[model samples]
Target: MVHFLPDILAFFFIAALIAQRLSVDLRLPDAAYQLITYILLITIGLKGGQAIANNASMALIGHSGLIITMGIVITLVALIIIQIFSKLNKADRVTLAAHYGSVSVGTFAVAVNYLEVSQIPYELTLNLFVALLELPAIILGLYLLSDKTHKLNVKTILAHKSLALIIIGMLIGALYGEISEPLVKNLKPMFGVMLALYLVHMGALAGAKISDIGSNKVFIVSFALIMPLIGASIALFCSWLIGLSHGGATLLAVLGASASYIAVPAVFEQAYPEANIAQALFASLAISFSVNVIWGIELYTQAALLISSL
Candidate 1:
């Protein structure tokens, strides 16, 4: 049930698209919806911090860091492999590269629950690493794009509100850590209620976005679907080298395979406002994230078993 919440959220996303298509008047109150989302974001961060506090250790940090570093490398390697498969320009490649490099916070949250249920132990402080890894790929991808393709100023990219919020969240999470109890407690119920409410609101937003999508973007849609699978394959092979257990390795691969729809697109939209936000969201919603949540876990599990059999 716990491993299912993220999927539920993803469904809410689809519902959003469908609702918009249906022209339903099911709209969330704007102020209330945003307020709920804001609280949920803070709560997720603090909850992650507390999880880390519970499992904090030097060895855990060292191990998780190694896995995380591998995650970054896996994303880059995937980018190279993807370039080999189908030609994408440097800007697109960098955009795609950044997508894979950062862990999907939602996916990471889901995988952690899976581990908890399966009785697998992973370093919870890895949440900090998850937060740490969120932006570098975007930064690196942007620089790669600037040097090789679309030349955008670094300042413009850095100044994005979405990116800024992520940086702030990570910084606050780090500084607060165990010190974050009171605030977290006060925020928890608010987030809990908000998460429930905003899920419905997001459905409406997605519906609106879907209504806006058009037939001219077929090529862009194809790219979004293909990229994450390419990223995940490289991650799976590299996972063994990271010394992750079978379950952990599979989860890590999924993390690497997943794209940051919420985090990346929000930031990228600001920096590359001309770039297709719909493409990113659809790719994540329709292809990558959907694949991961639906049958990807089972698929990875089977592959892990096969590898163990060998």
Candidate 2:
């Protein structure tokens, strides 16, 4: 039973969903969600930084470039698909593409927990990849907006709290390596509990949005179900080309498959006020997130193992 505890934690998401259906008001305060988000971001950043400090080399730099390129490719493909297939307006197509293109820290956290419980050894440096994968999709999304007259505020996007916290944590971890070990050690143990708590909130939020899918329900549902598999396949191929371990490949697949519910939504809400933020969130958070949490993680791991064997 203990071996499956991490998997068991995922059930809280379902429980929260059920509670929401029953009109049980079990929502966490906004502040609590923010706090959990910060801790997870910083912890991931610190660990990745420590890994870099230990394994700093030109190869790592090269790999970082590849990861960034992967993110850009994912974003472009998402945009193209939305353009060709969906009947969503220009602004919404770009917006949804951005959400799909960006990575989700929450989903990444769940993948990390899954790897740990399975005793799968992935590169700790993948944490750095998480930070790397966050922005390119968003920048492209903003640029592709129909209103080109709207100046792109690069400075504001850079200063967004989520990205800033992760970067800050990474720098501290890399620079302070040994000195930061105690802090990392202390925070690491709390990861699982914190993640489970956060998922409950996510479940409730997703549950509330279940009936609020707005228009294009068929298209949105189809895209959410299918995009992750496509993303994961591409990522797995890249992982094999780059010589990643099974665990590393699995996590990379997760990163590729995740959609940015938090960062992308927040940025688009402010920057592209005309975009339908709730619709995008419903697809990313409600549908994509649920698919990844329930089945995608295990499936990706299996695919990674197969690739590694070949």
Candidate 3:
């Protein structure tokens, strides 16, 4: 697991750095980003839909809703901690909160890969949790940051690319039932390639922001490490309370721990234009993502196992 996973992530990361060093003008066009995002959202949605179709149950709905509430609690936890420790203003703190509260698809994919490679069984319906976890924290963070008189425009919220894709994919996947799987089969390989392209671009973007990250390195690094620990603690408790198996506990821990670089940032840049994009990008993409992908998964899994055993 470690051998190929590290190489795949490192290769794109190092490739981006190499591009930066060589002045090779490596950059992804906006079209490519949108296409990749759509593909990923749809893939998860279809998988989730497939899972639900095979085993539609009220209990699953309850579990999804409960896990989503956990997402909100996790968001607020991060926000409160950041407010106390960091000097950033309300907007920046909310921005950071929203990002940290949402799950990272890249990191989620890695965790799923780890479980698969290790032969541990996990809930495939957790993909639905991925869809569920995206919006609440972001909306809650925005509400917290908004003035008392300010009301969120629902239309505007629905129009966001990430939410739209998720909704569309979920609807098609759930409504269409067994038929969607065969149609999507041919498109699977392209998804991996697109993901690699996306990460490559992400690495390049991170490389470009190296100078910006240096100024707040200490604070960002600390938050990245510490926040996941807090999140995992919450997940460990909640998962045990809910009687989740080892794999379910780990995925929940990851959902609590992972941060969004892809979905919310697009909305954030538009919604909170005053917030520091560099800080959000640097913290989520560079710091938190690496921590979760590298060692946090194993750490959270072990912690969850220990907690569950007791």
Candidate 4:
């Protein structure tokens, strides 16, 4: 009963989906959900800042760059893998690449929740950094997948409300940590409730979209199961190389394997509109949704045990 938060979240997500199936009124307004997401994201940034404040040292800084680099490389590799296994055009491939290249906040959130449920701790700054990895690879994916007529548009970047919020999160985190007092002061209680509310709303919304899942969801389903297995192994080995603890390595591996359905897709919709948003969205959502919801924790736990053994 105690070890059930992940499953509980999954349950709500599935329930929300069922509601969607039945055509129920479980729709969380886009603005409302987005607002919740913004609050939580800002909270995450503040948390990151606090982490930096407590453990101010070179050891922590080195890993942040490495983490972003890992995500960037993984994004490119995902594009290659999707192209090899699936039939997608250059434009479609570019869109898919960027989506997969970017990490999913929902997936990462689920993983962090799972970790805390299991009584494991990790650096908080990573919450903000996870979102930050795509600034480079997203642009690169555009260059790779966008047409010649589609020059890099600054409006594409600046126009995103969610993107703006996330970037604000990072800045607020940096500022809160460097100058102001703790970001987790009086705001923690409000943010805490906001996080749970946001998660519930997001869960309901995600489940409603489940019918969006179908027979064609296989390639994504398989990738969701397999990518983490591969990514976690890579992360484990990489973690050992960097001299991190086993737990940190496994979590980072989970991070590496994650696909960004939320942030990346939004970026692609603006930057590369012609790309098959449907396919990319399905694949990214499928892999990431399945992993964090059900399979990812099993993989993480199994991998962690195996790594511990070997």
The model with the greatest TM-score is 2
What alpha-carbon RMSD in Å does predicted model 4 have with respect to the real structure? 3.3
User: Candidate 3: TM-score?
Assistant: 0.87
Alpha carbon lDDT of residue 256, candidate 2? 93
User: Over 4 Å off in model 4, which ranges?
Assistant: 1-6, 54-61, 178-182, 185-196, 207-217, 305-310
- The runs of at least 3 residues in candidate 3 whose Cα sits more than 4 Å from the true structure, single-residue gaps closed, are 1-7, 18-25, 148-150, 214-216, 304-310
Q: What is the per-residue lDDT of model 3 for residues 176-213, given as tens digits with 9 covering 90 to 100? A: 87899886686665765776776677777766665566
Q: Give the TM-score of candidate 4.
A: 0.82
TM-score of each: 0.69, 0.96, 0.87, 0.82
Q: Could you give candidate 1's per-residue lDDT for residues 181-270 as a string of tens digits?
A: 788667644543454455465556545554444453564466556665665666666555545566656666666667776666766666
| All candidates in order of TM-score, best leading | 2, 3, 4, 1
Q: Backbone collision count in every prediction?
A: 3, 0, 0, 4
Task: Please give the CA lDDT of all the candidate structures.
Answer: 0.59, 0.88, 0.76, 0.62
Q: Candidate 4 on 214-308: residue-level lDDT in tens?
A: 44467756665566565566666656656554455556666667666666677777776676676666565644665556657656756665665
- All candidates: CA RMSD in angstroms? 4.9, 1.9, 2.8, 3.3
Order by lDDT, highest first: 2, 3, 4, 1
Q: Report the C-alpha displacement of residue 305, candidate 3, in angstroms.
A: 4.4
Candidate 1 vs candidate 3: the lDDT winner is 3
